[model samples]
Target: MSTVQAAIGLGSNLGDPISQLQAALQRLQAHDAISLTATSSFYRSAPQGDAEQPDYVNACALIETTLAPHALLAALQAIERDLGKIKRGHWQAREIDLDLLLYGDAVIQSDDLTVPHPWLHKRDFVLVPLAEIAPDWMVPGKGSVSEMLAQLPDHFIQERL
Candidate 1:
């Protein structure tokens, strides 16, 4: 089977946030169809969309996977479920949030999934960590990761861990 490089955005603001992220990464690394390549440094940043919640621990990961795009997404969701992700609502706090940020340079638009994550260009939380590991990776229609990061204004302060 062939493998494609992919990027995953990781965040948690509920439970032991940093530990939750570490557990999620361990699960991803254990998946037979996936092999982790690189992971960005974890960051503590204020929540987006909602301010009432606790700050989040955020990071980005690169992987090599033989699973197809949707399957890879399913795998990520499974890890979230395994780690007790409680999705109260969008942007609300959770045990963990695993986003499939990119799958190689493929551009996909579907009811269930979007590659180069629809919000990838707008969210500096993901962009900072994403750029750390994939600064040169192009986002299909948008520009490179570093270019996007350079264009986005810093909103919340990100403290490196």
Candidate 2:
């Protein structure tokens, strides 16, 4: 299998989020089909919705994988499940969250997923770490990750850990 570069955004707001994220990273690094190449420092940010919920620990990872986009997504979803993540509703608090921010330059639109995550540009939690490892990565319909970070609205507070 050939290697493909992919990016993933991770966040958690419930129950020892920092530990959860750290463990998730370890599991990611352990995967035989995936090589975690780079990672940004953890960022603390407020919940985008459910403002009363706990703040989240967020970060992004750059990975090299032999799996296809959907296959990679499946792998991520499985990891989340292992960490007790549930998709109860949009923006709900969870033990761990993993999103496929990008898959090479592949443009994919499917009922279950979207490459270059739909809201990545608007979320500082996503863009900040993304910029760390992939400042030059281009969002298919947008510009560079660094440029997008510069233009997003000032709503979220991202502090590096």
Best by TM-score: 1
**Candidate 1 C-alpha lDDT tens digits along 1-161:** 79999999999998899899999999999999999999999999998888999999999999999999999999999999899887799889999999999999899999999887999998889999999999999889999999999999766646998
- Deviation from native of the Cα of residue 35 in model 1, angstroms: 0.4
Candidate 2: tens digits of C-alpha lDDT, residues 1-161: 89999999999999999999998999899998999999998999989878889999999999999999999999999999998897878988889999999999888999988987899889999999899899999888899999999999865755788
Ten residues in sequence with the least summed lDDT for candidate 1: 152-161
For candidate 1, the per-residue lDDT at 1 reads 76
**Model 2 clash number:** 0
After superposition, the stretches of candidate 1 with alpha carbons farther than 4 Å from their true spots are none
lDDT of 2: 0.91
Candidate 2: where are CA atoms >4 Å away? none
N/CA/C clash count, model 1: 0
- TM-scores of all candidate predictions against the true structure: 0.97, 0.96
